[model samples]
Target chain A: MSESRNVSIRVPVLARVEGEGALDLVIEQGDIKELRLRIFEPPRFFEKFLEGRHYAEVPDFVARICGICPVAYQVTAAQALETLFEIDIGPWARAMRRVFYCGEWIQSHSLHIHLLAAPDFFGCGNAIELAQIAPEEVRRGLRLQALGNELMELFGARSVHPVGVRVGGFHAAPPPERIHAMREKLAAALPEAEALVRWTAGIALPPDAQEFVSVALRHPVDYAIEHGEIAASDGLLIEAAAYPEHFVEHHEPHSTALFSSYQGRPYLVGPLARLNLNRDRLPDDVQALLAETGFALPSGNVFQSMLARAVEILLALREALRLLADYHAPASPWVDATPRAGVAVGGTEAPRGLLWHRYEIDTDGLVRNARIVPPTAQNQARIEADLRLSLLNFGLDHADDALRLHCEKVIRNYDPCISCATHFLRLNVSR
Target chain B: MSANASVRPRVAVHKFSSCDGCQLAFLNLGEDLLTLASRVDLVHFAEAGPLDADAEVDVAFVEGSVSTPEDLERIQRIRARSRVLVAIGACAVSGGIQGLRNGADSASWVARIYDHPEAIASLEHSTPIATHVAVDFELWGCPVTGTQVLGVVNALLLGVSPRDNADKVCTECKRQGYPCVLVARGIPCMGPVTRAGCGALCPGLGRDCYGCFGPAESANTDALSAQFARLGLDTQAIARRFQSINSQAPMFRQAADKARAAGNE
Candidate 1:
């Protein structure tokens, strides 16, 4: 007969993580029993409400899904609509999209690194607490974050739900003077970003390398931030159009957000996955910085995601600098786009991972059906798996500490945005 | 208290019924965060860090709107815990995009969105935080700008009041020298009544203002509604303009109600 005991780990409030979520683990006689990452974030039925809205309103509407990465939603929605219409947004527009996305990367990655991930490395509850211990590091992280915000504000008009992003292109192209003013600050920020990358790389990652099906966009040239074909480390190459063919989302009873899988398997996305699959595609400067920091490709240690985020910051700084230096304002900010009645799919790399949006539009451009798969929803299963593995090795006597650390590690691995997860904690021990 | 002790104020970022975007703004601070952290202790931010729920705080940045019984209770608790509680974003200052259901039949909205409405529990109307608790200050936007967020933080830390100009978007549009879309192109623009902080974003984009920044102080919503009607906008269309992202905001709400009433007449 197996001895069984119920262990409930409640985190009154999960620290150093975005939004709220709680972990409930039931272990009986050391044999793994039940693990549930309960996501209690009230369901905001975006898909339901999307029906009957105009296609032109999608980018603006879906952008509200996540405040941190609204551009990802806006860009992906625009791309999908453009594809459906067979509209070509010229090179300048595409380049501008890339530039705009780089701003998102800088902003999102810096937020994840300094505020969300740093406290774990230093054993602090949050960044505010960490400030007392490491003020300079926090300051540097904020400055880098600020520069990213500045970039977004320059191009998008507002960082949160940017006004400039439209289906065809921006409402207005930034004037030369605004672009010029940002150049010097961006150039100055490059080294600070490089320093941050090194600092992140130096942190001691938790000892483990579980095999993960790393998924990200792979571009033939340049790092994939905005748009590209979906590629996995396990030799799966597919077009963005084929995403639905291979991947599936299941409605789990515990979460408002659906859990996703690839061919019945959990896959990893986000910075680490991108770094692993497209390391060579990175700009030479970023590649060299990674090499100098000894950041190996396909780093399976999820904790190193923070490091990967920092590296992306470096890449963003370099790219922003280059884009600014070679800046030529487009004559027209947008192309005329007329919506056609059809079903469309759009995929773009959100700050955390690949964000996909699909919409079915009527002849009048009214949305008939909408399906959005956020990065956090896709990452939920992998997080549970990691938590299971991490806990398998933990001693039961240290259950509380072990469970807490393991949960934090799992959360960190995916850089899970519980708020984005459709997304907190309390401890209950039953003997 | 020592001079330095008085100088370095404690800061707390709180969440209500929101997407956590406004609080994410703090994390989005990145490198500047280190400097800001040194200036103030971020005491209780559930999204950014783990802190005791009941911890006393100096300055609270509250995000989201009051949408449920829990939200009402939580906001009250937060108000009691903090010395100064500043509501951030549209959800806090005015009900956000989700507030569009206000003045409509809540039961119909619930039926339209949920497969099992009985499984869920929520208030009939989504309201701003100030409806439940006294808000010391408010920063408006769907998701507020990082600059405005930083401005408030810096001002609070320095013991000075944050400056939020209660002007309409028309001021910014005039300053930017953009041609009037309403007059030139016959678009139904809300620039005359919408708040200024978003820098006339929609107008800059060659679109009429959708009023994401909410209505300005003492906004002439009545005149704007009349102008929109004169521009060939039907009552339903005019109602929709006021019924968008900042639907529950007083100025916009009243205008939308009037438009709906006109439609019935």
Candidate 2:
């Protein structure tokens, strides 16, 4: 056992994630020598592409960033421009936006749980193999995912890169009849969402407690899906406008994504982070369901992220049902907002985590400058930090395949949207 | 046909430089997605956890555009390994929204977005996969619908050539009985020149189409641009309508150039 072993491991392409990346790890003398989560997803230069475009085009334009969470980009951009132009958007549209976002959460989380992450815990190569063993669970996950997509299409024309959101509000309202049909579907899925929580909680998750700061948007009276002030587990609370003062994204040589740090420290931002900071904000029934699982709030173990995603699905389903029970078509789906010259900033909770957007609009209604900080970019440093700790905990002396699988498991737990992150790995290990 | 062959036809899904939306069209198929595994050997779809990039296959459905040197090399390798390569979405057919960077100073944009632009590696212009490799077919859309994708797969399974439609979006819009936004509301719509695939989604939603599907066959871009001008759009706006997601398409590129030159007049 005292003998030293040297090996080089290269995961040329990290699979089952949102976008393309590879992982590189180097071990020497049975000790960790070098570990780098190389994110080579080609930079699309989205912020630069936003310059000189009209404010009206941003919602649809930004939706191209990530297919998995297109609603996040659209909603955050609309919120920024609407906040800048001083448009109210009214209560009806406000409540509908939350329901729209809930659809994204349900679909994205369900896709991750069944298609991406669940297979890892079961020692299956892919969901297809997992399906052979657990057909009912896989089918249930797909049903929930389809239902979520349907909710999105109710307002959006389609789920992937949906095109319904505009600056002031939506382009068109769903007729009351359509809303009625959707309400029935949401009510019917309640029992299924509850079962998802119980099923995920019952899965055996690995045990590794590590220290990290959790960052998310926190609303005063709600779970804060679409709007909120920026809050962190370290007691840092600030208006979305003040986010730049605390958070600084720096360029790294290996990644196209800018590695974001909160006060020069790697922090967490995702389902686990959101639940950790806002567990009390859940409704009474959801709180009771979560309590039944016996899973403690503010969990430090990253493997518990699966449970958090499942719990949030139930929370989103209930939230959507409550908002849509009294649905009515508005006289005007959107209002015209006169363009103004000023800096616009807004933050919203994407399924992955907090997504922030900033824009400078001119009196001519053109975007003068733009910047977007997606969740995966914020979690880059945190993911790298976790890889080092989790690998060492799992024992570096293990086989390369075992170590590589462990690395992918940890990364996928964050549901890193590399497609969104170029705005956010190949694994190579040398010993 | 491989349908009757002893070996199941192996299929691979490849990614390049764009959003994951087009490939997501496959996963978003939901129930059909599970059944798809039973029909073919999905040997190399990275997002779904199978990662054999070099696996030779009967069909390869590629998403995104070739935007970097790495993308340039990978697409060729995919074309070599694939028997029938189908380019899906605007990015693979034209150059996607990132193609907006084409004909501009890409280095400047990189500098604007990053602190040290020297570290970033990308091509001067994002180009379609067809620019580098021969594409057997093209499914044009910002993101192709699940039905369109399933249709192609089913055709391949039946040992027949998949069909391509080159009709304009206006045809689909008229067929759906949606009021014409251009004539009735004076909204500048791209339906007259944009390809038909999205089933007139924007027009059905009471908004104008933005030409996400690129140019249809023999699209009259000059007429569309002239119509846009009559709708009170300026030369700049007229140019931008053709220059959005499908800016890299030859017809749209020419329209954008002509409109921009007219602004000088």
Candidate 3:
């Protein structure tokens, strides 16, 4: 076959992207023409359901949006609602919440790196196959994931969509013994997390580079996870409250999910954006480890997104330990929450990237309007843009399987939570 | 269990209109996921691996609700391929939190929310798997826990009927030595009628149960509603309490309707 022969490749289903989505690609004369990363997960109508519901129900309501990162939903919702209430539960509550978020990062990142992304790296079909060759390493990764789940269960009664988080603070605070027990488990899991960073760093990453805006939360006191000012690599800084004013969610004819852009351009979020924006926030030892790994910083290669995730895992584990070190139960688990009519915004860095929530509340504490822009939807356009560049860079002359696998690799690098991403998709392609 | 020890029974996990939380219950198994994989021919599960939609399996774990034209057809195919079908969460057994739309004006809801309602194709109702196909077993939770998932998988491996606790949440609350938030703090709790799989999680944390696990077998929802009214909860407040998480379930749906009706009267 001629290298320049036109080819049409269709992946009926793309796995490990969180939910149901497809990829349709068409190439003419070895030059990529149309690539639609179609996300067809059924629209669950969450925003519509939120109308007329009490602000108190918002946390649990959003938590059901994505299973893997329910805390991201719960935390983001709580923060946004509390802003409307004008209530801050003090230092103890804030620290506990951060640790809780670290738990989410640890588990979510661990699942992606080991179960989803690792299989792709080793050319294995899935985690079951990956476990066969690297049993000990996979077991270690599982332990790290469990430790993260343990941290979540410690605060919330059970890990999956835990109901223990209320609007103001935790529904209940674990006693000193429970916290100490978790500390011991987390302490043991730290080395495994560091090993994961080194493991991911050692994997051979695809070579590609391109200029795109990188946006993430920037914190002066620490690595931004829960609260910070939103900053983009293009020198765009805005308060979390002003998120909607600066960014516009585009409704392209190609898809249903609202893909947001900054000033009419697709921007990047998640681990790469976070690390590039706040690599300095990492601990001195972690900084030294990054230097040892020989991965360059502020690079435009979207393939290096996994490396960004590895870096965050290390940061999450260290932060979890640091926050839990001097833990004391809050005098009260939650503070008084008296709802007043207000509109507010909350933004946090989920395992994948920036998760932003906006809400308008009525005088009765009922949610008048709610808008959730999860990380996956924000990266939809960026992923499509990368698809064309990635395929062209990899040389479309490669076999169909090779081209398809590389395309899947680039999407996996984003660690998309499709359940969270399924805001819209219909294909416009012929193969 | 089959006498042929060498033969691994085929198992598959399927999704419909869900948040992927229930299937996450299986992935959240951590190390146990690998163990479960060893014992079964893990054929299909999108969240955990590649999609093998046509693969025939001995058991199918169905999550989410039937809320689209595509979901209706897909559930039929999944049912045909499996010897035993189990509904894995409130979404699969009842219509999940999204099931809140079952009683409302779905068309107006879609139009008011979605920017391009024409682009979205969803069924008028989101109902449990049992409404479409026979469910051999049911495991109920807003998002079923890892332990409960493991328990069901083990039962399949051992050739025994899986243990599903059908008792009310109050039984577990009493066993856990947690004080009743309803009696002690005047909080509106659904523990009296909500199912028990969650270990009475909310009440233990000094919060009221919001009934994510759905109603228990022969649930005394009417009695609980009367108690809430006696405890000074207005009919509207009581209606919202029953009308959540598993709102589409018969017991809860009726309870919520009666509460609203009483308020109007």
Candidate 4:
């Protein structure tokens, strides 16, 4: 009979991240062990609560699912219901959607970069501490983040959980002057954002590489922020419509979020995956910024995700500028969307990663069924896998430091938005 | 509040059950953030970076609702650590949109999302931070605006009383010279009763206010209810409109209660 050894780890509070979560790893006999990334955040039951609510109420209801990427929820929910109603918002409306989405990416990615990711590079507990050491860098990062929020406010009417988004389009398009004002800010922000990319790329990254099943949207003409077909590094190509058929979510005992597997395998998404898969789609300036930072495609060092986010920030700024330059106010801010009985799915690349919404609507346009799969939920399994692989190499005696850094790295890789993944909020860790 | 105080005030942002939007709002201050950071000690902000070794806080900006026992205890600790604790956003101020479940069974809500309900432990309802600890101020919104957040920070820095108006959204609408969507299109709106911080956003976009900003100070519920009734909306629909988004807020809750009571009568 073989003797067994027990290994356990508990993180009292997970730091430098949004929402709340804890990790518990139980190792027996040194070979491997039980790892639980317990998502004990209380269930708000957004899908259940969404039942019988009018289709128009979806943007507000779903937007509550994530504070970080409320626009993502609003866009995906609006898109799903709009599809059910067969409402085709014109190019101008679509451009507005792109603009709104760009705000979310800027806000969310910048949060990840300065507040969440940079602390690891500087050996600080959080961004606030990093500010003490390098105040200018932190300030530049915050300004860039604010610029994103400005866009959200200009287009969506509020930075978080905007009320202007509707099924067909915005409640009202911004005035030309407001768009121009935002353009001026983006112009100022572009250089700072590019500098951030260069600065972040120079950070010493962890050398471990994994053959990632990177997943992201691929648009033919530009870097895919709002609209595109879904593509993965493993040669799998599918339209957004085929998402349900290609990927499935499984309920795991350790998490409230459903772990998603693409064709029965764990996959990676978000800025790193997007940058690697769609580098060709990025603008020349953004591509050049990537080159200047020495960032290359298919780089599996998860730490470079911060750099990838910076690269995307550059792309978002350029895209925002381009959209502003060609801005044309829609004849009507929104089209009348009459809900019909149907089941529909809407998929979009949220700042964090792929956000999906599926809904069944009745003839009266009330939601009969609602299922939202956020990027964090999809990344849960991969996060645990990273923790398991990373920590297994490091022994239990150094568990606290190893586990903390390991957990932070794993979380940074996914850029998990726990708020979007759970309906209610709480973070619990039980070993 | 001394202008020439020797030590700069320490500000820390905390999270419970939230979207991290309120903290993001602080980050949204941009270049102003550098000035703010230099002016004060940013002690602990998890969404921005790492947690401080010490838990002491001078002014704590707390986001999210108290949705668990741990949150309840953490709020108490934060209050003990801070001289001023400001509850930011709908979640922290009024239990947020998730508070829609306050009237429902939390166990059932859990079962709806999870396969094994027994594995999870949670409170029956999501409640605001003030329910657990004394809050010096509350910023209302589904997600509070960056400008308002900066205003609070600036007020605290300047040692001046933070002036947050509790006017109705209608005031902003009238100021902006926008047409009334509810009166013109018969769309149900909460603008007359909703708080004013959002600058009449939905109405500006040609839509009725959905009241993400909670209710105005001393809003006339009876007037709005009668007006909604005059608009030919049913009692149940009126109740739902009042109960949504800001349902847990006092003024909105009172209005919803009045509507329900009126229906019962």
Candidate 5:
């Protein structure tokens, strides 16, 4: 392979991540000339469709934005509306909400680790091949994933697009028996999740450390999941209300999805970023497990994101167990929310990363406008940035197939949810 | 033990313009997913790491609606290669929630969202997979569950025709011994006319059915709307109830139109 020869790689459809996307990369004179993570997942116009819908419907409506993390959208939307209505969801609703969100983190992280990203390191084409090679590990991953769905179902009725969330609180609370059963299941899965942390930490990850800013939610008393103020590795902290002033989303020619940049630069989100920013918030045992695995926090290596996801799964399990320890059905699940005219903004840590939402409502409770900034879209710029640096480091002269695989691995490592990313609205679109 | 891979039914899960919830039904199968992979040849499921989109398969589970120009061409190619094309979830069956744009001004909606609307390759109307290509079977839900998807797959693998349950959600509620939210709590429920599959999920959760499963066979949506009106729902509210999730389904479409027209009168 001569360095002078130009190479072009086009992946028509990127497999294994959420929604439709493709990659186009070009190397000129052995220097990376162009790289575009072309997210062709068609715009769903969710923001536009949200207009005129009542406040109560926002949770279910937004849940459709991303199936992999529906609870993220539900919780974020509910929080936004609750803030505007000035309603207190109370301690019971608050605790249960965290448990519900834990279910999402566990299932989503386990799925990504086992089925999506793990096979890449082992030279397997898919999880099926990986299962043939390591059946027990794969089975354990599926069991943990199923347990997450079960936890979600215990409160949500069904996990995929759960119907339990309402504006003020939940539509119904799981009885004490169901809660007890789930607590036991969560307890049983903790060991399995801990094992997952060890297993991912041992994988042969490519040592291609790069410079990037990490961003996630930061709760004062907890490792933010359901609620938090937005924080960055660069030491910037702000509420969801100040998000638009700091973060900007713009459309690129190659992608239908919007790319988000903070302070005019690409920053990282998701499990690795969360772990990087909030490592001290972890419970002692979970922290001890990470320490035992010899996985350092604030790791610059992007490939260790698999390990990061596994660690989060262990943390989520612990969080769910602690929350469900003392379960009592609330006499009323939701308090009545009155219609009001105001703007609402909320930020929460979705399984992937920070999911922020804003809504404006009329006195009749009809939504006048809506905007959602999903984690994947925020990471789009960062993904392309990583691709350029990673491929250059891995050598552009490698075979096209090798480059494509590496590109897919890099993108999948982010666990980019293209569906959630493509729903952005550009306020100044030229007619 | 499963049969030889070469002879087993080949399966591929495809996505278009959806949240990936329906395709996730395969992954959500949890342990059964591994069993399914062993029983079938999963040559092209992108979420699980296989990316042979053009591979010929015995059964193709298509999720999401045809919302883009590329989507239109891709669905046709899939239909050609697949021996049995199954459209899964509300997106594939009746255009899902994204199909809400169908009744509204789609171009204006695009202009409102994207800076370069011309750069966005989107069809004006978000449509079901059936609208673009021949579909063998349709599974309805905002997101079709793992059990529903697996039942269809198992039936196809066994060479038996899968059952299509057209009964309404009310029937499922009756069988489950769950009280009706509409009659008991004065909530405007869509169970009387919405299809059964969720096993009356929302009703069991003490909430009104929002019709994620689309319309039942010969559903009297007009009567349901009348009932909703009597329950103190405004015309717009009644219309919105039918126009959600499965807005593009024929019965729901007509019901929504009628509700809006009645309001105008």
Candidate 6:
């Protein structure tokens, strides 16, 4: 009778990452039947509301989409606007943009590595429990997170929705003294960031690797963050403007998020995807650091996502230090953005993954239309795919408590921007 | 894991429809977060842990705004369990950025982005908690600063009335000795009407204030709107100023309505 019992599970995962959504899973006689990572995140209808908004308001408008990755939205929207106007932000402003992005990568990734993901790995309930178990480690993680916040603070006043980001460039530049001051602070946190890499490298995550299709942006000279070509592990290269031509979004009835597919197959994005596509672009020290951990690139284990985030934190620190060394005020805070009617695309790597933005501006520079593909929405299919595969491997017929914890572990690995995905999930199990 | 007799106020944080930024204010506290934990029993924080949301608590810090049926029910449930339901950030106090949708056609807003409008379950408007249930007090900011969050938390723990300065951003800007971005640089700013506590950060950076903190204690919004016109901002542009973060607040909403009326004229 026990063997014949049907399995039904619901884990109401509140936007543990700052959004709201829930999960529904059904199992029929050991075979997983239905799994819907439903994101009923109250439809803010961001893209719809963006219509009729001015180009100058793009940064402010999009930044409101995700508080965690506001820089990603601001920069992506700004770059798209710049593309339409056919204006260069100047070399100084361009380099400065990378520095600003580095802050986001550091802060956002560190938050995940320490607060969100580590608890699962440590077999604890949350970061606080993990803190009790490993006080020093938790302290280091918090300090690293604070440094990331400080990095953003140096550029954008505060780490949340920075007002400094404008269309063509920043609203203003930080003084050299402030940059030097932040550089000194980052220097203090640098060693701990490397330790974060090594520590996550040693975490005895279960050896679960599978075939994966990874996607990220590729730049000519630097580790891609601010702007790049859309590159995939499948050897697909599409101009940023031609993103819609290759990728398609499908609205699943079960989930509010639009599931994106590459040629109608599940694919991966975020830190792991970025590391796979742009490993060579990483600095020599970072490359050596990755080698030192014996963690080969192009990994399929989603858990190494934690490792990938840690490595990105180190890279962000190094780049920030270099950029801040000789910081100066730009001749102008922004280029003259005389918006003309045109359609353009801009893609940047948010801490979680690729942030794609496209805008059609009218003659008056008001947004005629906008399409934003946040990384979490792109990774929704992948998250469910991983859940389906992992649950089956973990034996879905197991007790509800054991199965639910494992499922939450797998979900946290992606750091799903649940706020960005129509997001909380509550767990309910029924036969 | 500790018992209820721990002599600490059981505090829980809840979210509605806004970004997790305001709640992050607590975690972003770094070492201070631990200090805060020592002072208060953090029973349920979705972003922080997997605790029970229905757990009875002495003080409940609520973020975000009511934008869906679930949010409506959830706020009611949280209010029942919480002794003091304190609203945090603009989302709780003024319906946040999503509140901009209040005057617009909700159906069109959904139809604009999603192909399947029927799938959306959002309420017609994103509204602050005060509209649905009684709120003990509100801390206003797009994302309230760590200082404000900690101040409120301490006040709750000590049973004191939370102190919000109720000053305008301009007062802080003046204290910081930064020349007015609007006066000196001709940049249209909402500093005159926006609240303090964000440290007048925008004006300090030579940028205009976008009113992340909602309206000041007693804002002269009409006078400021006229000042914006004198600075050469068109009615539409001036309306956009009051239309970002706190557009649903009574004062900001009135100012935006006036500018929009003028724009139509």
Model-by-model lDDT, in order? 0.78, 0.89, 0.84, 0.78, 0.90, 0.84
Write one digit per residue (lDDT tens) for candidate 3, span A121-168: 898989888999999888888887888888888888777788778888
Q: Across residues A100-202, which tens digit of lDDT does each residue of candidate 5 receive?
A: 9999998998899898899888899888889999888999999988988888998898888899999989999998988887888888888898888888888
Candidate 3 residues B1-265, lDDT tens each? Answer: 3234348888888888888888877777777788778778788887778578788888999988988888888899999999989899988999888888776787876565456778767888889999998999999998888888888888987899999899999999999999989999988899999899888889988899999999998888888999999989888878888888898989999999999999999
Model 5 bad stretches (over 4 Å)? A428-431
Candidate 3 stretches with Cα past 4 Å from truth are A423-431, B1-6, B112-116
lDDT of 1 by residue, A85-171 (tens): 888888878887888889889988887787777877788767766777988888788788778888988877778788778888877
Candidate 2 stretches greater than 4 Å from native: A1-3, A424-431, B1-6
Off by over 4 Å in 4: A1-9, A25-34, A132-135, A288-293, A392-403, A424-431, B1-6, B50-56, B147-162, B257-265
lDDT for residue A5 in candidate 5, whole number 0-100? 73
Best by DockQ: 5
Ten contiguous residues with the weakest lDDT in model 3 chain A: A422-431
Candidate order (TM-score) = 5, 2, 3, 6, 4, 1
Please estimate how well model 1 matches the true structure, expressed as its whole-model Cα lDDT.
Answer: 0.78
Ranking by DockQ: 5, 2, 3, 6, 4, 1
lDDT, candidate 4, A42-87, per-residue tens: 6667777777788888888887777778888899888877877889
Question: Residue A6 in model 3: shift from native, Å?
Answer: 2.1
What are the DockQ scores of the candidates, in order? 0.43, 0.58, 0.57, 0.50, 0.82, 0.52
User: Against the correct fold, how does model 4 do in TM-score?
Assistant: 0.90
Fnat values, one per model, are 0.58, 0.75, 0.72, 0.70, 0.89, 0.59
Best by TM-score: 5
lDDT measured at residue B162 in model 5 versus the true structure, 0 to 100: 87
Error of 1 at B139 (Å): 3.2
